[model samples]
Target: MSSAPSSTVFLASPDADTPAAAQALATIRERVLAATARGTPLDIQGGNTKRWYGQTPAGEPLDMRMYRGIVSYDPAELVITARAGTPLAEIEATLAERGQILPFEPPHFGPGATLGGCIAAGLAGPRRPHVGAPRDFVLGAVIMNGQGQVLHFGGQVMKNVAGYDVSRVLAGALGTLGVLLELSIKVLPCPVAEATLRFALPQAQAIEQLNRWGGQPLPLMGSAWHDGVLHVRLGGAAAAVAAARATLGGEPVDAMEAHAFWQSLREQSHPFFANAPLMGDGQPLWRLSVPPTTPPLAHSDEHLIEWGGAQRWWITPRAAADVRAIAAAAGGHATLFRHGDKLAGVFTPPPAALRAIGERLQHAFDPSRIFNRQRLYR
Candidate 1:
């Protein structure tokens, strides 16, 4: 193991490395283990889109940006493996060529989002509830734990999560558990064709429509957050989509329109981003994931509850106490997705057991607390 500096200013720079699979793995493992020994934390960053998330920390960021690229793509198996630092756009393009997709509905801000960041955040677009979360398709990973020891979890062969399920456990873990060097994810083949249906319905009616479609085999690629319109995307065989379209009365929007709509929803652009100019000094953006059947818009007055009914994006200038209360009432987890403050907590209340488990895992991987110390769990 190599010993590097205790800490370095961790923004716009990262612990660098090459894109080669072996080289990337070696560098990440070395940096994380060293971080643990030095008792220095790391600031894990991607395209830096969600940099404002939670409380920002001061430490050496084990920047994964340097280790990037697709490692392997097996079209027959529908599994794609890539370095953690590989850009999401690159992943999508690779999958598109093979006629396969992530199916978890990953959103890319630009040419910057890395595969590692997506897994750590567990971000899924409107199609999440229907298919699954980022973890559902997660097959395996090669990670550098906090202890500076490299560990591989899950398996390349399908249906092979034999013993401990560390791969699934790390989803949405915010790099608190370990540093993902490379990941092997089960993918889905792309459909032959796809289309979306836009219906103008009130909030209640939209909810009902979504539930109805959920019961049926409508290939819902994405839905929701259209100013006042309820947009439901259907993807699959052209025959299937056409049949579904015949039953409904909707003017088919072109592929361009549909793609643009989904991309916006993927990144939470509409409604919230619309007020960018009006936002002064930057208030925080809170994301709440609620059940579809919540009290009919109890907090509707304060925030914009979109995505059928599950995901919500609340932009408030109020205090954190008020936001947490609303999320608790709505039945979901509250996360400071984007904020101006560098010291405010990103997540609401993490369960005691979960926190304890996280701490133990952190220690196991990084005994020295080398990576992002107290940034997530503190």
Candidate 2:
């Protein structure tokens, strides 16, 4: 839960200081209307944890903190519908009672994160490659577009095809597109057992090993690198996992320990985050996505590589030019994910055609571009 430190900080989702009521939706719509009439950018925000991921918006910031709750859930249908501002943890907890889980394995991202924020940012955790990305499971959304008019896409029904799939498109639009009100998505049953294995291998060696093993038969959920260590998690029937582990040659760590390990890894809570005399001061974190075949970073720095080597979470204190240079050399691009906004191009700049389409959509939805205009696209 988030506590409102001041008017400038309207904390949303599991707010420790504030529990948004059902009226938060009306309040949000009202504020949005006011902003549209005034033509001032609204500071669209959800989770502060991922705030450092991209460019800081320039606006009077809009926080969706007041709108939070699960609207409905059906265990038989394996679908859970909730308000946009519902905390992901709450949704997952509710689903757990029915033995269903978010197939995407979306990161809870602490208390302040909201379902709307997660979808808007298209944020995913280490399990993404195996389960699916955030947007993949997003079924529908009720949003208040730039004009403060409510809109719908998809629906609660899984077989729905009533309209354009702008629902998924809105997933990573970063609120520059529209303000999400409520969303419905599919959920899955949690695996019976889970385990994570960590190996102290050099980056190049680990890359080679994973590439080779990737060709073999095994249940590999996802892999990531933090500092100089490689961590891999496996989930499924307990028998298969045990067989896979025995053949993989990594020491086995049970579910409880693996959970703690992943939590620490995801939040940068391990020795990787510690101050070491040998490493000097650590640098900012950059999230890079590229082809898995891209060579290991030649730069002298630590990286947390995930998604079967397709994602590079590089940590270094390099200038924007240098970061972009590395990304180009590796046939990919970079965005500042943590500790550095100076080097990021927020919201992963889209292709020219997409940008034009985005602008057109932005104009059509928000004629004044008054909703978080300065936060994402700009």
Candidate 3:
């Protein structure tokens, strides 16, 4: 069990006083216990920005927004612990003040995004390939299970693992296992310099070039290909970024403009996203994860390649079976990312063995099935 220094700073909302928070936690616990006893379901909610994600939501609303605040932050130790409902904006602002950042670069889908929702959603931004994902940064977590028991897993430090690390499992769980109460995550120092460069090339050429650069010792942070343009972002020490820029040989974009470009891509606010409809049919968006070496898919006109070609965003009306088969042929899987018919299954079906293991874990953690039923899988 690791603890923060006593001189920790707490950034909390006005209504989230100590007594009120304690009472709120108690109420949540009681509600969970009652639901478990009655065999009812609980739909955990924070910020609700990502309510559209995952399968159709279920269970009674268990609001966690009142339990908001930063429990601890040690810049020297590169760790921050916060309550589940803490605002993502506040957390980022606090980290910015110390020239530190969450290396995973989790996206805030909307203004009211919360820390817990970000961790639960587990959606990383452009730097995900270069740095890591939300699960990689998770050091520890405190959660309330379906039985209303508070359980702690992992520790505040990265090396404290002694067995199965349950903390990381909570990432992308969609709150099916339990309700996350607090989380301690690792952070990294902000890069001293950053730049984005652009190259105009065909899809095949862009994929080849991106994969080639991936093997080299460069400050490559993010890469995306859209509209016949490949955008590469380099971040590190000033010298390294400049050296990589020279080696990459792409026209440099202005710093401010580049930042905005990346942000638009990250938040899906770019014109490409706005015009993602396939052949103007207003079809759903699909996400395909495949080997970077895989060639472009057939009839994928409205698409953007990201994560050095590992992630492909497709705006197509192709049937789920057809899209999934293509992704499988490419040696990966596909996800109906947004604006899709979720009832048809938003995620690819897991292998039988993997699904069995998930079921066992779910039963172990939530015997009564009181938490976010069928949100992750049917």
Candidate 4:
């Protein structure tokens, strides 16, 4: 629901000066054009930190790590443009210096996580439900299509577009549509205050409380339920956070401990994730996206409820179809988030009409099927 601004000054070219980035860009175009002519598929990669998140990569590796750096950043405008290979950590540090942040709260997974990988995966942190997804903050993107054509969509300023928003669509596409070269995203000022409170409750009661609180005007930033306890984070004005804390009436977590807890959850490094069975024949971790208002799901005790019960993570040995069916019945979808059968399809199968539309879009952008073939779907 965000748009680019109508008029804005063009900052320095994102690919300027860096000969390596320029070479990489030119090489990608040349390789893409040749691949298109010869029907050779290409697998785009940046940082490689998220290689295990989606289907197994195919085709020749096209490394994008060398093409990186902040293209432009206007603190006053609350926007930052960077090459696709720029490390996300660097961007966060830059924003921190300006007292701003990427509100979507993308996960780094590892030290090598890059901006392009973040966008490609489109994985948001706990703040997602309160703020928005990575796609919502995307203002513009420069990409190379299957035919090696360089195309630009959207721009630096919000409210700048009047047509189809292809920039946002590129998000979570897993490189099937094209090779991302650069991206521009909107940011926001850092919250003045933040606090986390924990309460011991059953899963059902936790879900109810979260949904109930969600309806109010409190400055809720994040929430999660695990180990027979519900943890809620509040952020905004100092007075507001304090008031909400008093009303919620839970044990206040130490400031330092709360910060570490959120970071662990964001990076999936917490013990809960570590203890989950690995991807082999054992139970694989499943991510279910359901409505927050939905009650505790069957076998829900074994799950970690996040996003105020909207995103549930469970490790189960059940078949993909069975897990997906349960999610679908609850008016949501399930994804084999990690350590699953990639060939069986990591995501829930889309409906016929949606599948057909996705096919059309894929063919339109990559007629030769030379980019990450079968990455998102078979």
Decide which is better by lDDT, 1 or 2: 2
- Cα misplacement distance, residue 198 of candidate 4 (Å): 0.6
Candidate 3: where are CA atoms >4 Å away?
A: 1-17, 162-164, 275-282
Worst-scoring 10-residue span by lDDT in model 2: 2-11
Task: Write down the lDDT of every candidate, Cα atoms only.
Answer: 0.70, 0.71, 0.86, 0.86
Task: Score residue 214 of candidate 3 by CA lDDT.
Answer: 95
lDDT tens per residue, model 4, 271-332 = 78875533324458899999998888887436789998899998887888888889999999
Report the lDDT tens digits of candidate 1 across residue range 197-311: 7777767777777667667776666677444577777778788888878866577888898888777777756555554322245566777777876645555533554556777
lDDT of 4 at 270: 75
lDDT of 2 at 151: 87
Please report the TM-score between candidate 1 and the true structure.
0.86
Q: lDDT for model 2, on a 0 to 1 scale?
A: 0.71
lDDT of each residue in 1-378, candidate 2, tens digit only:
122122211113322223345467668888888988887888777765456545666687677756767766766666677777778778777777666678766655467778888887787776787778777787788788766678888876679855437877887777777788778787777777677887888887888777777787667777876667887888787897888888887766677888887776555565655531112334566778877767688887766678878888776777767887778788888776656445345445768997798778878788888766656644
Among all windows of 10 consecutive residues in model 3, the one with the lowest summed lDDT is 1-10
TM-score of each: 0.86, 0.86, 0.94, 0.94
